[model samples]
Target chain A: MNGTPEGTPERTVRVVIVDDHAIFRSGLKADLDARIDVVGEAGTVDQAIAVIAEARPEVVLLDVHLPGGLGGGGREVISGSATLLGSTSFLALSVSDAAEDVVAVIRAGARGYVTKTISGAEISDAVMRVADGDAVFSPRLAGFVLDAFGTAPADIADDELDRLSARELEVMRLIARGYSYKEVAKELFISIKTVETHVSAVLRKLQLSSRHELTKWAAERRLL
Target chain B: MTTALQRPPLVRSSDRMIAGVCAGLADHLGWPVKYVRLGMVLASFAGGAGVAFYAWLWTMVPTADESARRNARRPASPIAPAVSLPAPVVREAPRGPLPLGPLPDGGAPPFAVPAPAVAAWFRTRRIQYGKEILLGAGLLLVAAILIARQFGVDVPLGTLIPAAAILGGAAIAWMQLDETRRAGLVDKTKADQAGGWVRLAAGLALVVAGVLVMVSGSGSWEQTWLALLASVAVLGGVALVLLPWGLKFWKDLETERAGRVRETERAEIAAHLHDSVLQTLALIQRRAGSEQDVVRLARAQERELRIWLYRDAAKDAGLLADRIKAAAAEVEDTHGHAVDVVTVGDAAMTERHEALVQAAREAMLNAARHGGGTVSVYLESSDAGSEIFIKDRGPGFDPDAVPEDRLGVRESIIGRMKRHGGTAVIASSPDGTEVRLGLKAADTAEARIGEEKP
Candidate 1:
């Protein structure tokens, strides 16, 4: 739950910023310093992995494009820090709204994705959510997921692993249509916890599908 | 047959020997340069006719570059215009909303060359001779001919007859040069066609003349037959020597064509970027004082460009998705709100769906006016029906609280859908409002069949 007593200063989310732009990192660190603890910062993939490893931050804010590490960028950082993935959650922060890069890092184990244009307070909220073990889906990411999984219920029985449950589909659609988790809960007549559970379940199915249909879908569309 | 009237404009070639007169003549008449030079030298002895003609050609012929520039207006045919970049994604400064779709890349065939290899066989340069080397050979040949004439070393009639036959045969084979070159370029002007006919006829006349002289002047028919056979054999030998050169020429043409395609693609991409992204960046910079305006401009441009890039994949998305996108865009532009549209599957816009689109547009307009931030529009067209969800993160308002005159939601969205045999559901709470428009398959036969299946 995001609700916590204001008196507990130790409840600040430990975070690492991974972006190639130093100015962006500094600006973000300054903006997020009030609510989030900026434990480490890195500008490249190798640096990101090293800093994340050293800091053992609760959440890593990663840029989709990085200067190093086999040219896979944020995906490489997430995979490289696979050991820390169990204890440390990774959240993708990018300026690109491209589906390919977003899907790539998500497939590589990013807990959530938020665009760079997001406000500092909003990004802090996303960080806290990821730190709380919840999958944060932006409207665009929700739309991408809906497109990849396909929203039609007719063929749901054929592809068990790739299909989204009816409830999950409803949740994803609401999110895609720019509904916040709290709003989605209110609209669906469910609790905020239930909304988070549905999103987490969808995220699990996205990662667990044998054939990453998301990547294939994006590739087929030449989004890659 | 060899009429000089209406001849192609004689141009001095850059690839030349001496004054390029002989090479120019060879090019126009489809004869070998060496043979034409030798013929001219021999004709010079006939009252200096060849020397006078060469001087005239040197004075009259335009240089290669001049000819090339002059021919700029000439139809460079056979190459269809480069695949036009999908007619600039017509973006209208959003009065309301903009339409979206991908332009199909398949526009025109890139090159019309029938077969580069085959065409190259006739066009390839079989001989590469230096200017100085050709000049030296010409001088030596002239000296030898003059010396022989002075010594009165009577050349045998037998040798002279065969030499004539050989020259005639060579001319006949050379006629293919211009014809094939025209074919290769695939831009045969009427003059070139007429010239080709004349060259063929002249070649035929020469061959006939050579045969008649050999038949009449020789002592025996066997000698004449033997001379003709030897001429044919020489032509075959020349062809054999040119085989590798033809192949090389073919390869060169292929490489050149590939390069042309790459250049075209690069130019198209650059033009698109300049028109869309660069222009948007300029607009953003000009309006930099307002952060909101800058963000709005960038976001709209980004969406338009992305849709254009993925136009191919979106091509089959049909009218439903495009209509919804346009609706979302209209709201965004008019209200300065961000609308995210994601579409899955597509179907034809049946009459019933018109109500669906209108309702969705109304919903989006409401959301933008009331919803403070980004609005999401998700459209899915499947076998059953098309479903559109227009959700907004705004302070929820009760449908009944609004005055009866505010017919936007009640009359436009809800009433419009109900009249068209569709359903509209509005879910509003403290969090936000979601307007779902569902239109069942009224006219789609496929959907009717799909419903029958289960």
Candidate 2:
């Protein structure tokens, strides 16, 4: 129930292979098995869901259109099938990479989407990424995704204080040293009450939080 | 896909709001319109918001009559924009109306037309479309700018300008295609017109916002962020929305251009054919006694014609120099000695003009050869009609004097003159022979507009 240590390699990534086309599934299974031990290979979504429940593969290679796999006599959009795959990281395998197709799948909970025309190596990489909880998408689709959802800034610099006086730094260090209002007053030869005022001034100048946090931060950075 | 769309719905295929009409129609057709309408409604509503739409319906129950419900299940054909024509269909291999046999002779026709069908198709429609595109683009530009202005917005135009320009140019281009399409100028398609406006709108909005974000002291660059997002959004949106249409437009343009080129080549081939190969075939047909003989002789003769037809002629021989000079001189001086002409060595053998000159010179020679002569030559490049002639005072003979191996009668007199796009005629026989050669001059740049129709 507890979290593993940083960089711990304790968990095995399970995978489920699903495709309506038998030959494709068989071949995909052989490849996945040889590369990264698949939990189960299901020829259809029905079998795959059953296998997924039984084996609990972390990844499922979800086909876009699964014939008769929707438990109905008709065909549905690839998105409908995606929603049925549950929380298992769904890596979409399809022959279509149309902008609409890519967006539809991603919007349908597919962790990764790649065209079937891709080489075995690329497919393997895509599968691995999806299994590892990373979103894999084609370049255009990725752009579309970023376009639809506002993009986040990659770098955020901390605010700078350009005009703080040099005496402010000494006052900030002393304040960060965990000295009491009275102790700092004696150490710096300032009035005890004057020390409290300097501490307040230091907080405002350096944009630091309360004195307790400042002490811990100063101790970590060797600023005291 | 086209065929699938043709299928009629259970309802009136008029609207898509409810299941009543679909249900009634389904009952009539022994099918479930309710389920069908449900599926269709689900599919249609799922386009952008399926869940939210259903939830809204669940809360806001409408009080409508049963008959109105019947109306809702029908498809709304009028609301949907007409499907843009499919991308130019890639024609399968074989070209031309029919394999009218191999490339014909007498060199290719000089005035070959470019895609006549495409030209003819776009001739009337292009101008109308181009104007629409222009109007739409202009309106969209004004609207977008005014809206942005109204909102107190500004944006950098550097990036957006290019996109708008691209659209504007495409719109204006409909007007320019007349040269390729023959008499008809630009015809913008619906897709083209829409795309142009959309482009202008997107560029204007995004650019204005982007500039505002940069200049004004906005709280957190949200305007610039949105502007950038808007620009990208417009690009993606327009591309996704108009890709098939734009592609179809481009393909049509390309095909039209291609059609023009192909048509030109075909015309050239036809002209060459009519001038030589066709004439030659006609001769063989008349001469050959039996079908078998015609077939056998045609194989050899056709091969022979195709063979010598492609010889290397000199690049820069002064073709028709004598004719041009003689004709130019003829316009001024009327009563000159019957134009006496001479041909020096192989002058500009490869020049197409040389062919006309050769024909003219041959006409001159034939006049002297047949009946010594009073000949006159006249030519005009700008003033319109171009002519060449030969006249001499000699024992003027009649047409009856055409002897066998008569180069003048067979090749020069008839074939040569016709091949030059002119005719050779005997003007008078009053103590002198006068031979005249005249050809119609092309008013504009000599062009061919022909396209093969399947």
Candidate 3:
């Protein structure tokens, strides 16, 4: 993929790695492909917010448990930069697979969640996916997001599910059930790029984290 | 016969049904207590003399306190009588003192009293019983005077009765005035410490009797003044006896208070050790790397110490699951294998729970050592019992092919569950291996019953 076609110049994905462990950040930075640029790094919530704001990276890899900033952890970094949320997306890279950790980061507006054990290539691909406005998740963590938000809508407030447009709801259920952007697009008889726009709108309406969490949310509610 | 000179026989206060008088007499005379008691009861039918004699013995016999004091003073004596007497003698020696040969007196009695020993014994007994004898004589004299008056003989009842009262009170006061004697009496009847009212009443009775005597006396005022002085002397002696007892009681209270404070401080130190030392050990167990085996050994020690410390804390099932997860994590870290632990339901960590955990841990180790990449542990519990499953995706082995000497499977896992009234089932094919350990509540009850029967 890095061997771009004969004439066009390659565009690198601008990324910021935020993690508490220095060794993990450095190792990840070293392992990432040349097509991805690690523009900045931060170990704490405040530092992450500051670096993300200053670097204006297209993708921020966040750790769920960071040292500072109102004790909000990774969620603080996301909420602290609300204005940047429109232009900059987040992909959470954490060592924890705990259901609450996954749900918290997702609800705080991370576009995906993956464990530290994932290979560097997978992490790079995940970064590109999040930068392209697509949700990514490690296969195991998808179940947690589904279980948390996928409960029957009868138990949820009517307005919570009712706020979505019919088309957005269809997109949500499909995306939440572990469907990729291309798969959701084919299923809905829509263009692949249009599917991304609908997913972004569905995520905004439902206040969810990523497509993996969306699959969990839809599966838990038995919507798919 | 034991000589009184060796060590005066003391009333066994702890062995007493009522003042230990019979037991003491039996001890001194080397007679069975039942026989001595029977003799006293039979003698009591002869004009009530036995009751008075028993009371006299109760009053004069040196109590345990006096015996201890005597023992303390004569350290050179081989037999410290009080120290030699076993505290549990009353329970063990219910048959009473050993019987000797027939007595020379008349009937073939249970005890034989040597002639010289009896004479020497009486000689010493007379001195101890002297005040009681005097009081008895004084009572007889007053009775004789009253009888004389009843028969119309000219006898001054008031003067004679008051004189008897004064003599009896003086005798009691004289016997109890010595500090050692007072301590002996106080220790024997601990109730006397609260008997101030009784003492006051006795003093008031003596003064009333003396006042009557003074009113009826034909003698001069000097004789009446002498009787009043005697009454005052009796009251003063009673006060002297009570003073030392009160001091001893106060000192004992102070000692007890100090002991309680020291106990509280020790308990506080124990609580501190529980929190700090155990917590540090737990942290080391989690963080230690290449020292994983040492950490596990320390963790086991910590668990035992915790069990000993908080013995009454109920072991929750959640904690059992947590322990299993921790064990799996250790194996994962040490061997570079991935283990996923999942738990369902909650219960108390009973013996069955512990057995399941141990078996599961063994299974996990087996999987990590011989099986594929990722191992999964599942723990589920219900009201019936708990179940644990350890699965690995490694190439499976035939159960029959296992070496006879390999105790990891045979003893650690299978034998453990069997002992706990549980079952361990292992399934291995070329694809993977899975071990399931199951414990049932009914089986636990049966195992307990089986244990009790044997």
Best by lDDT: 1
Better of 1 and 3 by TM-score: 1
For model 2, what TM-score is found for chain B?
Answer: 0.24
Which candidate wins on TM-score? Answer: 1
Question: What residue runs in model 1 are displaced by over 4 Å at the alpha carbon?
Answer: A1-10, A152-160, A211-215, B1-244, B313-318, B444-454
| iRMSD (Å), candidate 3 | 11.9
- The DockQ of predicted model 1 stands at 0.31
Which pairs clash in the backbone of model 1?
A: B96-B330, B102-B311
lDDT of each: 0.72, 0.45, 0.63
Docking class of 3: incorrect
Task: Write one digit per residue (lDDT tens) for candidate 1, span A1-224.
Answer: 12222224468878899999999999998777366989889999999999998999999999999998899999999999999988999999887757788888998999988888777777878888888899989877887788888775426456666788889999988777667787678769999889999999888877777656666786875533
Best-fitting candidate, scored by DockQ: 1
List DockQ, one per candidate, in order.
0.31, 0.00, 0.03
Instruction: Write down the DockQ of candidate 3.
Output: 0.03
Error of 1 at A122 (Å): 2.0
**Model 2 Cα lDDT, one tens digit per residue, B282-343:** 87779777654554445444434533442224334344544454442342133222342222
Write model 3 residue lDDT over B340-406, tens digit each, in one string: 6655544566677777888888899999899985676766565567677787868999887889999
Tens-digit lDDT track of model 1 for B233-297: 98789989998999999999989998998999999999999999999999998999998898788
